[model samples]
Target: MKLKKNITLGLFISASVTALAWQQSGKPESFAVNGNLSGFNDSIVYLTYGTFDDTKIDSAKVTDGKFTFKGRVEEPVQGMLFSRDYKLRLDLFVDKGAVEVRGATDNLKVAGSAIVNDYALFNQEIMANRKWVNNIFTEAWNAKQSGDTARARLLEADGNKWYAYEYEIRKNYIRQHPSSPISARELLMYVNNKTLDECRPMYEALDAKVKASLQGQELTRRMELLSKIKTGNKALSFAQTAVDGQTITLNTYKGKYVLLEFWASWCGPCRAENPNLRKQMDIFGSKGFNVLGVSLDKTRDPWIKAIEKDGLTWTQVSDLKGWNNEIAVAYGVKAVPANFLIDPSGTIIAQDLRGEALNQKLKEIFK
Candidate 1:
């Protein structure tokens, strides 16, 4: 009886810590965001965040560029602040508290919460340190787009150190500040597409309370899921409603080398890769390769239109639920344009092989 009581108490404390991590909140009933955007007047602004269909959390009318919002959050999560016209966009890290904002669209800032400040500071430092790498990457991208592959490769080689240093810097910060929600947040982001072994050290290094936070719980879930998605692991079988209202099943594609693609209609990059993807499909269609598209589109019209416009001839499926699509959540697909290459035996052999990488992999397999 005593052992069971201890276990229950432990669970209770974990839940309590997650709910009350926002200090100075006194476990407040709700959070308030007060803003002063002196550069504009009589406008509408929005505060939006959440993974599962709660994107638009709150909104307020700005009178003379001043507005106020009152809401509650169970844990720390990033929110988006933007005008109704969508011109001004800024990242706001928020939890329960009185968060204050001041300045114009170009210079807006959030204050009155340590976690929020840390989030801003982390961005500033990362940008400042990564400026050189960013320049090189931008130049490389331009070179590649202009068909200057040689120069693009050269620029990419030059930026390799900065790329590695960025990872090192991130790992250092996460280890040094285990208590910060920013640490937990970045750690979770960094773990994307990584193996369980790669993420376990830092995941274990996080503060106990931080690990018990909502994001922490998500991280745990991701790592657990990661084990089953690694190379040599069997592809997870799934069934979903296709765009044409028919049921689609992964088991039907078991005998072919399949590209299980996750994308969305609103993703510009996903659309940009359509022509190249179509070319690959044409070349490899008879060589035991096929493509399956999984869309994260919320509406039917845009989803269907994008398929027709992009000339995507593959079987596409979606639940018309946007980010709330259960398959996306299952795969931890925070962003789109991701894919997994499954072999004939239903084993996931590779992933995210875009552009030239995808071509090279297919060539090696089909050669």
Candidate 2:
């Protein structure tokens, strides 16, 4: 799922983009949600992500365990109601509104009324969070203005506290919504900025949890591994089946310098790179250098056709698993036109080699 983030603490609300609302989209501005929520009027309902303001509550009256929200917006508006920690969930995507929430709160017992009448208000409330964060910095700024060194330091401490709080909140959101791409990215940003303490148990725990959850998610896992691979010195091993139906292991090329080439049948860039690779292969074939081409094609016909058309004379191997190929997973290859050049000792020497640079390297080593 594509995830988007529209708010940041460092930015003012006026700079924030308005969230898309279902009520404004001409779909349906009205919704009746019924479940088991008690207290208040059963007709009362709460709304969030409805307005330009930050407060989550819109408008509602409870009645017969049912509540309704009436507002309109443009297309692609999403809504949901959940009991703490998402124990009970009701989520919907509306191009227009007109949504019904019969089973949303069916089993929850909630007191008090909820309403999100103005989209602007909901946005404002969300901005209020940022304002709270800014207050920490504001205090520091005020201290500096007053020329109080001790107060400035204290306020700076407060600002760091706010950063930690925001980081933790984003972390918890990622934990609860393991599939939320936005939360995952925000957490990664914190990690990259070194704002999240690497030595903290919480940091390690969250990393382990996310990695475990994303284990089989090809794209996410590949992106993550690709990020690490650029900085790592370890050799990667993978197994795939050859067109002849023989299983091939990457380690089989252990004693030789290997060029792990990732490509596809439909990729013009890859096709363009093929001749250069073949030239290098020709030049280095008698040397220790070898080529192992892995195609990302899903079909055998195009894969084989491309090999012939491109004249890629090398040890071609693939499982015919296409994009889901296990070798691709093991190597963290997310895109075609990518590669890794490894030395005879099995340490990666370079990646994404192309054009004359590729030939230049081979010449240096083998000539």
Q: Find the candidate with the highest lDDT and give its number.
A: 1
| lDDT of the candidates, in the order given | 0.76, 0.56
Each model's TM-score, in the order given?
A: 0.76, 0.46
Residue 169 lDDT, candidate 1, scale 0-100: 62
For model 2, the superposed segments whose C-alpha errors exceed 4 Å read 1-183, 186-224
Off by over 4 Å in 1: 1-28, 49-56, 85-87, 127-170, 195-197, 243-246, 299-302
Give me the overall lDDT of model 2.
Answer: 0.56
Return the number of clashes found in candidate 2: 51
